[model samples]
Target: MTSYNASLRARLMPIGLLLIAMSCIQGGASLATSLFPAVGPATATSLRLIMAALILWAIFRPWRWRVARRDWRDLLLYGIAMGSMNFLLYQAINHIPLGIAVALEFTGPLGVALWSSKSRFDLLWIAIAIAGLAVLLGLDHGNSDHTINLTGVLCALGAGGCWAAYILFGQRAGEVNGMQSAVWGITIAAVVIAPIGLVNAAPAITESHVLLIALCVALLSTALPYTLEMVALPRLPTQTFGTLMSLEPAFGALSGLLFLGQALSLLQWLAIMAVVTASIGTTVTGRSAEPIEAPYPD
Candidate 1:
């Protein structure tokens, strides 16, 4: 009985970690958005990245691991991608609902997952994702703004593209220094984005609540979630991890609804489901789970 229970616990622990990681990330996004009205996305992204970078550096003590000059390019690229994702996704959530922004941003990794696959079934998943995106893009119709906010949608897509870049560059960077590379990458992102963010958010930097929320965003979105993912990665099978990670958009939607009161139409729900389904299908059926199982910066 003891052995059986231990086995069951081992099987279940990674699942819980992934779930918690997703919740933290989405919850953090919702929290971050609350600051948008006061300081805007630039400031919020800057604060999150800066704080997260510091936390990661302290935890990893990256100075212990030195990188070759040859590998610095990959780390730099990865960091730039990370910064782009933070800035663009925050900008996206500023203009669009959290769920929609996340759903759209997911296309980046989805594309990466589908890339290099020759399976015929992958085409179906691609089509489903596209259909979901089509409906998602139409969601802002009849709102006070009139028509969809193309800027938000575009920003989400751009964020997704950066995610794809992060995956590719991360693979290369990891070969050199593993998680230390992530620390450097995040630090690089902070350096690149801090100037713009500080300028934009300078007016509200003195506010206590703003600082508190930014700290929470850093802990919840970047530090906590990334730590959870790193812990869960080795324990879970690649496929299981990928499938669970695919539910992140749904988590984002739920976070938006629960935290931000951003209720969606039934059609929007269905559209998000389609994207979720497509991601699941692709992961479950893919030849390799490498792309999906990669540690996400979301």
Candidate 2:
């Protein structure tokens, strides 16, 4: 009985970690939205990256790991991609609800998954995803509130593109030490966003309460979730991991509702469910597929 329990725990541990990571990530996003009025979205994003980079550097000591010249290019691209993705996401949520923003942003990985696969079944999933997107975008005429901002949708799409780039670059970066690569990559991101954030929202960012909240966001959104994912990735089956991660839209919606008091219409909820289902279907059918690479602090 003892041995059986041990085995069961081992199997369940990764699932638990992934679930926790998803919750923390979405929760952090919702929390960051609350900070936007004070620090602005760009500054909040900068603070999160800066704090996360500091924490990861202290914990991982990535400087101790030597990188090859070729690896530097990969890391640089990875950082840029990650920074752009987060910045764009922050900009997006400023204009749209968290759930809608996340659903649209997920198109990046969904596109990548479909592109990488040659299977005919992938087309079916893609079609379903498109239908969902149409509904989400109010193209289906189901939305009474046609107040969705075009710029916000574009920003989310841009973030999705950045996310795709992050995934591509991360595959190469992962060839190095995982924790080290993450630390250095985030540091580079912090550097990239610092000037804009500091220039626009310096006073707010320097406030004691803002700094404290930023620290909490860094831990919840970046350090903790990333660490849990790193631990869980190797243990979980690729399909299982992909399916679980696809639930991020639902989690995002939940976080938005719980933390920000954001509500979604019935059609909007169904649209989110459709996209998630398509993602899961794509993942399950894709050949020997790795899970969608969650772009930093997802």
Candidate 3:
């Protein structure tokens, strides 16, 4: 390829990968809802992780490979973070609207991204994001049901914090290849939840349809997009990757509507756009101080 085409391809690759990753996230939610009627968020999240771990382990056979002890530790930490983050976020979603839960959970990354803002422009972005969140809280119209559930919001925020940690540990885990890190990390997560998963997974496993759905969820939610991201990460800048990830909430809202018939209120939709715009505005135009690498192998 020519130099210009190569550069274009480099840029486009990340975009395409990110798009697919977001689609997977959206698909995950839809699939979970379809698989388990009235399923609690914790159960759904646990099942997804378990299924993903099984699939990855079967394919990679990380036992046959080797990795550094320090890297193994990083993967374990990343897996713990992933497990906790998913559990809390799903808990939030059970109480609140999925879109709102996702938006709230995004604050963790946004906060990390905005941590070093010496400029008024950074403050402006923060203000914009806060405004968007305020709209999301729906305090103006004084609709009680529309108001966010405090516990749920807190859980979402906790999930966001875990997500930020996941990102941090993920970089360390991704340093070496062959997906050994992912395998170990996911194994750690599954082990951590083994007690609860045993109780919840048994019922689903017994049902052939649920088993099929769980496998589908694992592929769409965890495997496919994660692989795509691993491929695109080296090609994209840290800020660019963060900006692309910011589009996840938008994709989630869209997917919820299309796949699960979960519609957002006009206010909620606007709120999602507001946070998304702020996140994009901050990342796409601004430079990230730290470089972030993808966590898994594509």
Candidate 4:
């Protein structure tokens, strides 16, 4: 088996990286909502990616390392995608409830899964999930602001598309130069977001508590989680990783409930269940005729 596939097998095991990814995501959401209230999503996101990149750069010292110029270009694109995703998703969360924002964001990958599938059964699962989303979103027509923010929903969708790109480019970066590529990729992403954060959140930096909260958000969301994901990604199949990632919305919802006191109505709870069930069903029973390839930052 290919090294990547072998790694996938290991990570796909129930007690492996899958659990770590979920944990990281859960921790990240809780941290973002509670600690970084003063900072906008973009600022919080930029701080985390920048701090995480700094840590990884210190560990890898990728600067002294050399790569082909072409590879560097790929890493740059990867960083852009990553930065965009962070900014957009955080922005989405600012306007919409965490659960709804996450669910909408997931549509990007869900669309990719549907488009890339060769199996009819995959189509069925994707259709069911999309229909469920439609039903859930229908509740927003004349409801509380928490129901949904159309603008935020669109932003979440944008972030999801960027996430798909990040995965695609990231895979290439990983393939070309192994972990070194991730080090550089995240650095580039951090640099890209730095200016945006400065412009949007520099004032808040003077606030002692805001700085502290930003650091906390950075550590839980970007620093630790990215490290764990990098360690895990190499070991899991692309399809399995995608399927496993379908849990992010559910995890986000749970985290919000636990930490932020975000409550869900019966319909919202049912929508969450529909997504969780469809995701698990697809992952457990759906067999891929060909390996699933995802896009990432290069």
Candidate 3 to truth, TM: 0.87
Against the unseen true structure, what C-alpha lDDT does each candidate score?
A: 0.88, 0.87, 0.74, 0.69
Cα lDDT tens digits, model 3, 1-298, are 6999999987797888888888887778667766445445566666778888888888778888777776777888888987888778767766776777788888877776677434346877788889888887776578786878888888987988988888778878767763677777777887775556556553545677776787788888777776777788778777777777888778777877887677888888998988998888777655556655445211
lDDT winner between 1 and 2, please give it. Answer: 1
- Regions more than 4 Å wrong, model 1: 139-146, 289-292
Clashing pairs in 1: none
Q: Candidate 2 lDDT, tens digit per residue, 1-298?
A: 9999999999999999999999999999988987899989999999999999999888888878899998999999989888999999999999999999999999988888888876779879988999999988989894467667988899998998988888888878878877777788899999998777878675676788999999999999999998898899889877798889789888998889889988998888999999999988888888734444543446
Error of 1 at 144 (Å): 8.6
Candidate 2 segments whose C-alpha is farther than 4 A from its true place = 142-144, 288-296
- Which candidate number has the best lDDT? 1
Clashes of 2: 0
How many clashing pairs per prediction, in order? 0, 0, 0, 15
- Model 1 agreement with the true structure over 66-162: per-residue lDDT tens digits: 6899999999999999899999999999989999999999998889888955567998999899998888988435554334588999999999999
- Find the 10 residues in a row with the least total lDDT in model 1: 139-148
Provide the TM-score for each candidate, comma-separated. Answer: 0.95, 0.95, 0.87, 0.83
User: Cα RMSD (Å) per model?
Assistant: 1.9, 1.6, 3.0, 4.9
